[model samples]
Target: MSQTLDAAAVRSWCSLALDALGREREEIDAINVYPVADGDTGTNLYLTVESAAQAVEAVFAAHATGTTEPAPADAVRAMAHGALIGARGNSGTILAQLLRGMAQVLAPPAPGDGDHAARLAPALRRAAELARAAVAHPVEGTILTVASAAADAAEAAGADGRKAGGTRTDGTRTDVAATVRAAYAGARAALDATPDQLAVLGRAGVVDAGGRGLLAVLGALVRALTGEVPAVPPAGHRRPEEPAAPGPGSGPGAERDGGPAFEVIYLLEAGDAAVTRLRERLDALGDSLVVVGGDGLWNVHVHVDDAGAAVEAGVEAGRPYRIRITHFGATAEHPPEQVQRAVVAVVPGEGLAGLCAEAGATTVLARPGEPPASGELVEAIRRAHAREVVLLPNDAALRHTAAAAAEQARTEGVRVALIPTRAAVQGIAALAVHQPDRRFDEDVVAMTTAAGATRYAELAVAERQSWTMAGICQAGDVLGLIEGDVAVIGADLAATAEAVLTRMLAAGGELVTLVLGEDVPDGDALADRLERYVREGHLAVDTVVYRGGRQSVPLLVGVE
Candidate 1:
């Protein structure tokens, strides 16, 4: 008979869940059909669990400092809360709410009589209720089905325990363990039946990925009950490995260092204290800890057996922006033969695409209509055989997707980087300085620095009259965005453009490159106005280049 769960037990369960998630994430991502190509259900659930695990670790650490035993309920609640705030995408939101319900059921009064197993049934039931309420239209074959089945089975098992003259109401019931075990069994059965309920799943010849993801979670919980830790999936199940390290005297592009021995990387918010703390924690874990901090972000690379533990430590120090764990054996020692890099530009016109192609970016997944999906970006990179891919999301709306893609790639052993360039002009500037042979870190720095040096200006008409944008914007009003922020709004396009240009160029610019969108009147006309401004202001100008094309938006100009 199982008794109570300790902090270590909780950690074991969380780790197992994450391992299960890691094993199936890609499969779930590939089979999602209801939402079309926006299939991040697996990724979202994985991130959500990871966030919760970190929270649990923090709770445990805090409890260890005191005399009191770690409260499993409290730690679980913290994890659920973290998942709520860190949740992304539809599936992620639903998963967060489910965990929230679980937390609520597991809260306070401390399950009387130390009957940990009895509480599982009620918690499962609450999770189902919460998950059902989260979705506007709940589907039967997805996560909802699995959770519901588990909850119902737990209730049934509890009833059976009572019928057998076992302790059910005392909360000291050891029979509750049996109930949870039964629940997991029922949940697995329901998972197998998912395809029968949803025709789409049947047609796809696979069970619902979301449903399977929930099963994985339940499986972890069951494993915890059995005092077992889940193992990470073998390398074959993950992303392809990097090439082997080149031998001695291997040519210029030869593999080096026998494939990095192990590539350890993690993400955290950027700060001196955070970096210092992470360095200290990683030092104890392993060697070769390279700490890189930039743009309010930090990436810690360390080789260690405790990858998850290292991530947990980082989360305790600060909120993690992203987290990736990969073994050197899982990836090639050197870069692939064709390290094709693809760039996604969120510009609003055609000229940007041409410029992107000329800059050596073979495939350009333009966000012409709706925001591009992460899968689309992933597919583009895969199609390009991009060993080291650089994503340039020139629109703020698409920035999150790019960042998520980069995080996913890193997890899967792909060398991916994102340059948060907010405009096509900035992307163009960065592309101008890109070097194919440079190391990824160096290339990213060079491109980002180049983008930062350029000033941007654009002219566009408002699409709506809603009380949006702080009442400063109206229909037909010309709007100008400086570095992606709406800085000037007025009735005249040229005046707004001029004001933005003047502000951006105030820091002293040598040349101005104006790439007008299809909506703009004419590139030459705008260039002439800018040239006159430069001559009249006695500003030393080198040259004015004008180009016109269609893009995701209108009017992208870069001044250097």
Candidate 2:
């Protein structure tokens, strides 16, 4: 039975591709040794398809809710645009152009012209050609090789099917599923042969990561059209890129070789002529120059020593924004082979920062009235000199900043998890359970759970008269805040601290942590008084205190 290519089929392909990539992300990332050994190819492909799927869904949603139905061209174009805007690394940028090339041939489906089904072969063929053309230095044994092979196989399949009397020359439905299956089969075959073509892959003892990702995407396309995934050859399953602390008899490693220092990517809005010149300039600057997308928009990717110069060339050509810079040698600060994992915490005061550092954390100090920027957090993560990291931004206002930092680190091939610690006390609670020997995900879960289970509070003096949750108080009055809001007001700092403690311990607590600032009325005396109050009232509650040093906020409190 033959199938016709419709808008629904295209939507399904995008969603299926995303799902397949998601399942294969870690494996693909592990095998990524080409261009640079900073592993992230699998993750990049998944993010690229995720963006495309979102755009396709948006088109379908509009058709479902509005009076007008979306056409096949609309869905395809949206997918291309989404990929262009959201493409991640080198492979992702090229993959976006490949999909865009397909749109170039199949969009605005011609009536009585056999629809998209008949055009699949030509679309794929063009996708391969365009993708190859987009790369300044097109190398075989990568995703480009797989894409080209897929297109060639699809064309060959169509030719054979026509001769076997399965022709659709009279403008009837074509065997779209057959075309997809052929493409997937060809990509799989090409993926297996990648090691022979690329010396890096051969040295790494793995197939091209980018090629494997493309194979998975093609497998999804086949699944969309045929209701079954293509049967890909099974390779001996093993993880070769898992990070481990340097030790004898640990990790199977490839031949160590250094490449470019940084990967710089950005979306540029420039004319084709400007892009042509920009390509030539960027090629001279570094390797892996994939200048994809066109018609006044382009996604630029390159690896270079001077990341600023790569971005500046885009500025000379046209407007480039969403600039992402990643140093390839993320673990340069530490011994290369010893690269393992670390925790990066943003703490407000010197005392907290020192405590975090003592617990084996890479601490980013946040001075009073100055929040750490996204770049600072990124640098701190890099300074940790580990392949994997857990980030704790111990302030409510820095959530967005922390998320952005995490995303930026991910592009540089660093696996960073951001734990939303709303206060320094929460960070402390999370750090208490930090176990580096545990699995990354397990450690993150333990930290997040501990942070969430703790209740945090702060005591400060009102600088000026203002309305409070308790009542309006004049300047110099003490304010007791539980979870960032004023809950009690008093004339004495020690009295206000005790009130906050009583309110927090009412629900029951096993441990109480107090960080007393320099402004505390006799730091040692205030902590002793609070410790006594907890002992006398909330029996069995253990208390720990730290000298917070010079800080604007008088006291930091937490109950767990």
Candidate 3:
């Protein structure tokens, strides 16, 4: 084994952590009793670490052309950044902050030749501190307490090694392997004692769910450093003397019994000062509040009755994207066993999100510049809380991301089918034909047929001079693209849209779908004009226009 911690070790650590979490996820979820008994702590931790692992792998991929692998600092920083933006629920949010803190200690570019092993103790300590600070109200006997105990033990071990002449009382320096082993041992001890420290765990006859998850992570770290996986029992397997009782706020009345009605999470871009104010405002509106990230980007997670108010607060702070709001109140009423099927779609705007939600699909909002990560898509699939799910990516660029999410969901026992809907308009067509009551394969085929039959086109304004299939266009020119290629360029938005629609209709169409973006001035007038043109030119065709607010393009046309 390598004596010093390095880039390869960080990569190994991430992969190992993800594996460990995957093994313990359901066990940990079964014992989830604190913060909220939604029973997703294990899954949340696994997803958070999966994001971190992917980030580290991306860093390695970026350096593949070089002579050497990425530096340890670069790898660790990538891991931290990935976790921040991709974090899911409350436990996931706190886990992101903890990784960020560790990265803060390990990612410095300068002071390159220091003892990396010695830094592990401080990194653990810093991680625990940052995690506790991120929570609105830190409670003991949870992941926070487990993390602190791990740090304390790692630090004590380091001290003891130094006291012994810094050479194991021999002639070799203390290695990272020893530090991680001590931390894992400490976390395991803390996890075992959590039931005594928290009343909920005691009543449930289980250790803290988050604590169990942290132990798995710490155990993974030990395996990454040394080549031995720590022997940690699954939470569900380790029953207390008494039969396990249902934890408080767990049954059908969880929401009514003082729990928040919804779980709101979003990624925000704001200045530090703005984020501070956002924290204050969110704290008053809900509980389980966690805001993690820095350097102008943040991930906000909280539980509240007014999901809109929580999101509005993020907007006031700055631009918030990839917004996800899940209704926990309804979850208690419909257990996982009861849900048979669901549709998960990626929409571009809040208006479209509302539209999809009304159609009984769980929506993941994709902002103009910021797209939802694969982890976010996976979380959305989980949130759908169904036995089978049909995923509509709605954009060609997201094909791979959607595929990866589908694979992940399948591993969690969700039957997922990925439909290649290349546009939101196509997604709309698919949703129109979605019938959850039908057989899963039959439903998927119907949605796919609808999406495929819809020929889509979009109208966008050029941001800079660019060459198109039709001709070269200058900045501020109206560009019309058909089926993902530029087909028309003009000075007027309406004229360009008409030209594109004419081309699409030349082949013959029965139905026309017009989605108007929020930015177009007097959008209603433009929609009316387009509707009139379609009606006049194609008398046999029907027209439908929708207000696709704040979408990426000025107009989207779909002909079927």
Candidate 4:
């Protein structure tokens, strides 16, 4: 009747939470009115939880050969770490801290040596407290309020249950189902009352969007522990008779309407002392400031007029990576206009996506095993908002998917051209030659020619003992693939990359491009070494490098 809070339960919680968020994402986005009103709160929370779920799955996969399952501590720690690194926007950042707080209590032994159900109350309380502390100025009517209410309800429910014969003869208290149900009910009530607490929500005739999302998450937790799906609430947390007010950012006194123009977020590796000072600096520089995470890692989020200054503060604090800065409105250089042509590219990582975006291409980020679906590509083409679109499927495996998306867009009255780019490096080459101002056919031909002329290779680790063109390779061997065939196998990343580069350069001519993945240790040094090797061995060849973020492979090589 009672589900124990073990590793399997944690895994199920992550999966269930993700599905719940996915279903409510659009409704939550519609109700987002606070902290900038960009209408992406739901999307941000979904991505954050998706990352956590993936991390938990990875832990289970790692123990596939072992007799014992992954420990609960390992699973929860991974979930918190994943959320911290992948968190986006203000609501998502606070949610990460909440999960981290729960992990603090759950990952270690209980103070009184209590059972798993007995730990739930304290975990919820810690989650609320830590989340409140993470925000620079804690708001009363947001997710923080709902979280605190849930904690209080959980504690109260445990106390009541113990008084009502819930405690066993051995002294174990209430079950997890009771605790989770109480928390979810309390959160739901808090969400409904948010309009009365927050002025903006009151004006908009809707409850707090972040609070509503938190309620959904707690509902999933209820299902995870009790095997009972909570009743779904109305859309946008608005009452049936209440007429909708103006949409966010449409009227006077709108929350964060004329606020800071940019939202900057990044993952920082820094000491606690550095973080303390860093928080003060960021608070002075912006509003909606939240610095979440600890133990030498943090996720820093802020809204600032000066995006560069916010980033500089992180640099002073420590090593900051996966930096994302989003503009809230149109820029001077790119005024709102219906374009004639646009490039839609499927890129492997965030860095490459940013690069392609800067080059005026609409980018769809492709994660390790999660390739973009045809519908997602179609959405990107729609987002491009152009008369003619050039689609680049960066991986060869996405060729048919890209074609389907193109055909779909064609039905929507958009001209589409699909470029057969077998790798990210080839996409980079095609982007280099793209000129939207040129004739549509001419531009397509130019991009196609550039992609075809570029020779591409990648560095990957063999998952198991396998036969290759080069020879037999064992698991953990760095296999250098040239034009999709294995040519060299080495023990080290730099060495294998070098071998791949040498082989590609033997028949090459002018320039070399290297894209380094996040997993590549000392990537800058490796890039420097490879560049030197190329300069010394090849005549009249130029070299360039780019950080590809967390791609599937260690290195991508291209020579033209």
Task: Report every candidate's CA lDDT.
Answer: 0.64, 0.82, 0.86, 0.85
Worst 10 residues of 3 by lDDT: 247-256
Query: Which one wins on TM-score?
Result: 3
| Candidate 1 lDDT tens digits, 224-307 | 776543332221111123224423433221222332333344446657776676677777776545453334554455556666
lDDT of 2 by residue, 107-173 (tens): 8656575467879999999999999999998998999999999999999988887888755555455
Candidate 3 lDDT tens digits, 296-405: 99999999989999999999999997777777654534455538999999998878898999999999888785577786788788778899999999999999999999
TM-score of 2: 0.60
| Clash count per candidate | 18, 0, 0, 0
Per-residue alpha-carbon lDDT of candidate 4 for residues 1-560, written as tens digits (9 for 90 to 100)? 23767788888888898899878987987888786677778877887887788788889999999999998889889888878876877999999999999899888855464367788989999999999999999989899999999999999998888788755654556667778999999988888888788877776777787888888888888888779999978646455555666565543236556689889998898999999999999999989999999999899999999999999999999988667777777422223576999999999988898899999998888868656656558767866878999999999889998998899799889999999999998999999999988999999999999999999999999999999999999999999998899999999998888888878888866999999999898888999999999999986999999999989998999999
Which pairs of residues collide in model 2? none
Q: Among these predicted structures, which one has the highest lDDT?
A: 3
Scored by Cα lDDT, where does model 1 land?
0.64
How does model 3 fare in lDDT? 0.86
Q: Candidate 4 — which pairs collide?
A: none
Distance (Å) between predicted and true CA of 165, model 3?
4.0
lDDT ranking from best candidate downward: 3, 4, 2, 1
Per-residue error (Å), model 3, residue 100: 1.3
- Worst 10-residue lDDT window, candidate 4: 329-338
